[model samples]
Target: MDQQIIMKIDDLRMYFNTNGGVFGNKRKIVHAVDDVSLSIMEGETIGIVGESGCGKTTFGRAILRLYKPTGGSIEFMGQNITDMPERKLRQLRSKMVYVFQDPYESLDPRKTVGSTVGEPLIINHLVRNKKEYEKRIAELFEIVNLDPSMANRYPHEFSGGQRQRVAIARSLASDPKLIVFDEAVSALDVSLQARIVNLLADIKERLKITYIFISHDLSVVKHISDRIAVFYLGRVVELSEADELYKNPLHPYTKALLTAVPIPDPFLEDKRDVIFMDGEIPSPINPPKGCPFHPRCPFATDICRTDAPQLVDMGHQHLVACYASQEGRLPK
Candidate 1:
């Protein structure tokens, strides 16, 4: 199969202006996402992982145009949509949808599960009559492994897992080509999370849908993602195949994140050295001068503090943005 690039994000940035300092005299800029670029391949799941405020969610919203980017271009299916009109963007909504973290909040409490799932179909004019709408809703329920008979029940009637299934069903209602799962399973129990992750993988295989799975849990993202991007303070520090990244992380932040994931073997777990970051994550309003991670990086040098490094491709398209990694000083 010929590889296809479904979405391309170039130099994407999202910033929010707010009152400056305690006096609130001047305006300050919150750098949510800064100069990040990546391409999503058709039928592949790309995971974005970082701490709570590392801009993973903002990056996803920017790609979907939910948050209009502050700078740079976004190309979806070869069409530049960064500056596209809202009227035109609405037409593309049917082809792309977002599955939020909390299903309870996303699904309507007042509406029946069937109605909730069918809303997108109605909005996109996917069905002609009431019968067609109900039929499509039933099929969608079954697609996500939910019983069609439960369509009439309210969202409160279902379990957490089931509600997420409904949310997935609703997203699938539009027959979207790309679905952004923004911390989609972080709210569910571990077992439920596994079930949803497997369902997402199965759906991708069956429907050939591309996904942008965002989560702070490295383990969760590792299970569902083909490639993973590690974010640090609104910037992508490293990006590579999931397996390769876990086994051989080049960036200091990436290595630290992997070490934090508990190992199954007691011996390996005890033997592994965990890297602890010293200070808290810098404020986005006034980040550090050079590399964002320089303050906490163990190998930070004068160059690292004075000059930021761009994401450099090492080999096999594995990229990292760190002076140590580029200088071959990273531990083997």
Candidate 2:
């Protein structure tokens, strides 16, 4: 189903300037997205999975220009958008929108649902008359399975699931081609998370939209992703199809992540090795030189300590950065 590249982020870098001293004197950088590169197809969902603080959210934000990138190029539909002027970027805002993690904090409590959803249309001046605006808002609400009549109500009146639905409706108001779901359902109840994930999938087909889904939940990524990229610290350690990644995770960090995902079976639970990783995540201000994951990896060796492994393809769309074999028989 690949027609053309919809979004391409090349060597994206975003570092936050953090003060680390008395009276906020010493300013250090937190290397969030470190020279990351990826291409997103027009309508495929690309899931980004990583531990918190590993830069998944930062990467997503960098893509949408929420955070101005320090370096690298972002191309949308083959147009270089890295340095697109703010006015131009603002004009193109409807094409790419971000659905934030905390629905409660993300949505303005003071604004009514109708006004919030219709804000985009008003800003873009997409409506000719008042009737058209109300009709569009009603349609968006209906699409997300929200009560169209509740447009007059505030966000606090709804549950977590419904709040997210309202946010989704707002994001869809402008008919965006790509939407960045930054832990979009993480704060919802377990039962509601599935509904949102499934709704995202269903709406993608219906609307012909592309998604860059950032989540720590591997299982949710497994559900919605066409391709999955596993991030360790600030670098991509493994990337592959959904099933291939889960079945044969090459990176030690990826393997550890998968092992930690609780399987819903009492019998098979004890059979698997839950890699309880030791040590806190190294400070992003001064990450290790070699592989960022090498310090905590059980398979770390001299080579891993000194020379970082590149992302080498192990065939069939699977790529990994680990040089050692788990079973100790194969060559690096």
Candidate 3:
């Protein structure tokens, strides 16, 4: 059976205006998320990976209507929500939620963990009485592998990992259908990250929830994602199944990112050649003409400097946006 598409985004563009001139009089537009389109299926975990400032987080927020997109359409659950009014959008908040990067800052220092977890339930009117609320809070805490007894404590009392678990608990309080996790485990240690990733996988199986996981760490994303999208300068450069992307990356930027991931086997790691990219990422406010990655791509051609390449399928559902890949100029 074909899986239902939970969310569909078309030509999603999110631009930000900021003062740029010396006198602060001129307004410059920053292309945070430019002409990106994707479809997320129900019960699937789609990972968005890229360098810092590549619009991974912005894309997630834009789809969730946390930031009103400058252009494009966002359809969630067969409803067009791209320009939905705040009042109407509020009603959908219970079904779609965001789990921020910093658990420390996301939680209130003054509020107890139990209250924090119950905030969504209270706002969505999920529970009727105090007893029902407490029972739901306990269930949420237990789902995240957190002790219900610790719910009475403050956010500052818990460790970074524990705090993140608390945040997860809060996000699940209303039984959301789709959750966007922006760098959810980036702040924790390696061990904690693995544990949290495992917990999320377990929860997804038990609850049948859909997730959009955004992060710059490809290694971490590989473990949790079913399909991965590689972003560069606010656009998707490559997208494919997680294992397929690692096995055969057609885009230069994707190849470079994979090379940077350290292999566990010392002998194989030493034998592999690393592709080092030249130059820094271009500023979003004044991005270069033509292809966004042409300036740093080693295989860039004349056409690459004059015309931007759109993402095209290269068989087996692997999509790439490189002129060299399309023209068969890149070495196999």
Candidate 4:
């Protein structure tokens, strides 16, 4: 069976212009998301993972048109929405939603949780009357494992996890085809994180909704993502199936990231050699001439320092953008 493409992004670039000089006279561009192209299929969750300032969140926001992209194109559900007017984009928003990391900030303090959840329904005119709105609000709460009666409570009344659940319920209230979860579980406690991750997986299965799960924690992403894309600075360094990425990481940076994730077994953890890359991530404002990751990559060569390598499929649909990998110089 051929899968339907939900979103198609080509050479997506998002740049932010800011004042640089001490006098605030010089214009400096922050390449938040640079030349990123990705295709998302319906009913599949694609994970975007990278360290802080790697443009993972920006990429997600760009795809949803939350930010007016400086360059490139974004096609959603077979329609080009990259330059769609705000008035028209508002109509399309019902099919796409964003779940922010901090529920406390996303939810209103004065309104009841029910009101917050049903805002989408009101905007989209999904309900005919107050009775339908109330009933749908209850159903949304129940879907996220929150009691329908709790809808009357305020955001301050709910715990962190519960508040996040409320936020999730609100996102689903619109019956969106795509949801962007930006560090949704990173702020929760370990146990809470596990429960929310499981809940997200369950929701995806039952609803058959596509997700863009953005996080720095590879372990959590592994559980929910069908495929993973590793970002560095403002570009994707590697992309592959979840299992293949964990088992055989082609890029040097990908290998380093996997090594950082601790194994559950103490004995095995002690025996494993962790690959520690030198130096911090480069500044996106003035990224390295060649690869964005070359500054910290241990396997960097002269070509890696002079020329950027584009993403290439080595095998099994694993795409990597490292000169070392392309030249077969990556150590086994």
Write one digit per residue (lDDT tens) for candidate 2, span 1-332: 87689998888888899867888778989999887888889998999999999999989988898889999899996778899988889988999999999999988999998899999999999898999999999999999998899999998998889999999999999999999999999999889999999999989999999998999999998999999999877778888888899887888788889988999998899887667677988878898878788789777787878877777888898888777743342222
Q: What is the per-residue lDDT of model 1 for residues 217-309, given as tens digits with 9 covering 90 to 100? A: 999999999999999989999999999998889999998888888889999899887887788889999989889999999999899988888
Cα displacement (Å) at residue 148, model 1? 1.2
Candidate 2: give the clashing pairs. none
- Which 10-residue window of candidate 1 scores lowest in summed lDDT? 19-28
- Give the Cα error of residue 91 in candidate 2, in Å: 1.5
- Clash numbers, per candidate: 0, 0, 0, 0
- Per lDDT, the best of the predicted structures is 3
User: Could you tell me the TM-score of candidate 3?
Assistant: 0.98
Mark the regions of model 2 whose C-alpha exceeds 4 Å error after superposition: 23-25, 325-332
**Where does model 4 exceed 4 Å of error?**
20-24
**Candidate 3's residue-wise lDDT over 242-283, tens digit each?**
899999999989999999898899999999878889989999
TM-score of 1: 0.97
Question: What digit string (tens of lDDT, one per residue) describes model 4 on residues 1-332?
Answer: 12899999999999998877787678988999999989998999999999999999999899999999999999999899999999999999999999998887989999999999999999999999999999999999989999999999999999999999999999999999999999999989999999999999999889989999999999999999999999999899999999999999999999999999989999999987677899888888898998888888888888888988999999998999998998889886
Residue 149 CA displacement from its true place in model 1, Å = 1.5
Arrange candidates by lDDT, descending: 3, 4, 1, 2
lDDT of 3 at 218: 91
lDDT of 1 at 318: 90
Q: List the candidate 1 regions with Cα displacement exceeding 4 Å.
A: 19-24
